[model samples]
Target: MTSARDIVPISARLLERLEALGTPRDRVLAHAGLAATTALSTEQFFAFWRAVEEVSPRRDLGLVVGAEASERGYSVASAAALHAADLAGALHTLARYKRLTCPEVVELEVARGEAHVRFHWVLATSEVPRLLVDSTFASFTSLARRGTAGAVAPLRIELARAAGDAALLRERLGCPVAFGAPVDRITFAERALAARFVTADAEAFSRVVPGLEAELVGRSRTRSLRDEVRLVIARKMSSGARPSVDQVARGMHVSARTLQRRLGEERTSYQEQLDAVRRTSARRLLANTDLDPIDIAFLLGFEEPNSFVRAFRGWERTTPTRWRARVARG
Candidate 1:
């Protein structure tokens, strides 16, 4: 039997569709040995997918979900159908509709003569990062096959340090995969933009594209600003000192006002994100490291021991010394 750790959060829509296929929720949960109330961690989520592979070897659950979405009046066509002016337009379409079948954000950006696409996920419901990554790669490949064959060149994937299954990723992406990266990015050839869509379906897509775009925009705006802020702060903190909003704004090439406005849209502030990072880091350090309080404070960018003490109290409702001691004892 699969352990509880192997289950990942799945969308209710996807689950319902699966149920329609005679895949009962209890059976799925039983395969993972996870309770309905449990949220699967990333590791467990991947394991659950592996377990699924064992039980149903030939079926591609991700594709099944995509097909279900297409059946439900959602467009699952390639972006090449739009007669996209360039690869960028195609990417925009892909990013816009990627979530109709998958909940993760697939980011596309052009920098230094290359197109980079990254998959960012919250995993609030699903824990299978590999499944997410592979599904995204498959979607891109399907888009390429239908829209513009040979449009997608070899790509590079940037993944979180904790991500697993490098061998599977390499084989599936047909590209290099790098771990411990700040963001998950897939780099493709710039020349792929010249390829045209093989069979354009503009009229069919037109019926549903607007709604998809609107839904994507709403979700993009609502996603966690804290996570983005945490990433920025973590990068800066790793390199040197922790950055203020103004500094981070400059790094993001946006004005401080713009940064504030964007964060406000997501109902978060730079300072609050910083505090969360500090608190999370503090707990991790206290539990995992033997660093003294003064050292820990400095490492966390606290200039004074008293300030660290105050922050620790706010975060843990106890002193760092006491927290560390309790963890050690436990």
Candidate 2:
């Protein structure tokens, strides 16, 4: 499985919303068990949501925060979109820059007289939580409502999970909400995209583009050696072969000794990284797929199903079958 970089930025909008509600950013991070202030991994992002749930008094935490963020949306993270000529341009800008924030894919397509927005958390091992989903959809609608003239509302909303607290969504979004769908989507009026952004400043937006582009390029060019090694290992494992340090290093144009030294500087060894990858990949396969332990063993390049089970027991303290069953029950 492909994993994301530490891509999810600690968004100002989320922190500011909590602060406005009289909660400190530090407090939330503390409650979330997160020490990193710069960005969150995809898993850590979920922990952040759990923190918001624990600290906030409002039952509609996601709705309030996401909507309010739209009211004063401009931030260094979104300087380009703040001055886009129209809603379409602003959304396009945000979409372009989303890689700097999170692993999720934000798709905005206007088709058949409707504007459809979809999100794909492609690398996630499990379900995206309801609160995160709500906040995301709410942010988009609120942005539209903030930017456009007169009353604006989504035509329809669809969610994949149970409808707990969905009435709050209807009240906040002013639309019919449907749940238990295969995918989540929000449908808006098509003309809304063409509506001019009330905040647009073309000149300012143009200036920020080059700097943001440079930052994005820098991110692409400087991916972590650990992540690169992980990907190479995954590819080799999927091809039914175990990749050694030497083979992995050769692929990256480095000597095995040099790779070991570099990884040591990163505070890890090749075997350590390999075990970490196997642990994560094993759990992900167990949780997300119906593949049996034997088949999964093949994919992980294990010599035998029993060997895979032994390693999984060491990592998770349960048989793969039991773990899968427990996850299913949840």
Error of 2 at 252 (Å): 21
Q: What residue runs in model 2 are displaced by over 4 Å at the alpha carbon? A: 1-4, 20-27, 72-79, 222-330
How many clashes would you count in candidate 2?
A: 0
Model 1, clash count?
5
Per-residue accuracy of model 1 over 161-252 as CA lDDT, tens digit each: 34456776666556787765434456776767666665455675677678777765765664455555665665565445757888778877
Each prediction's total of clashing residue pairs, residues at least 3 apart in sequence or on different chains, is 5, 0
Return model 2's CA RMSD, one decimal.
7.8
* Global fold similarity of model 2 (TM-score): 0.64
**Residue 258 lDDT in candidate 1:** 91
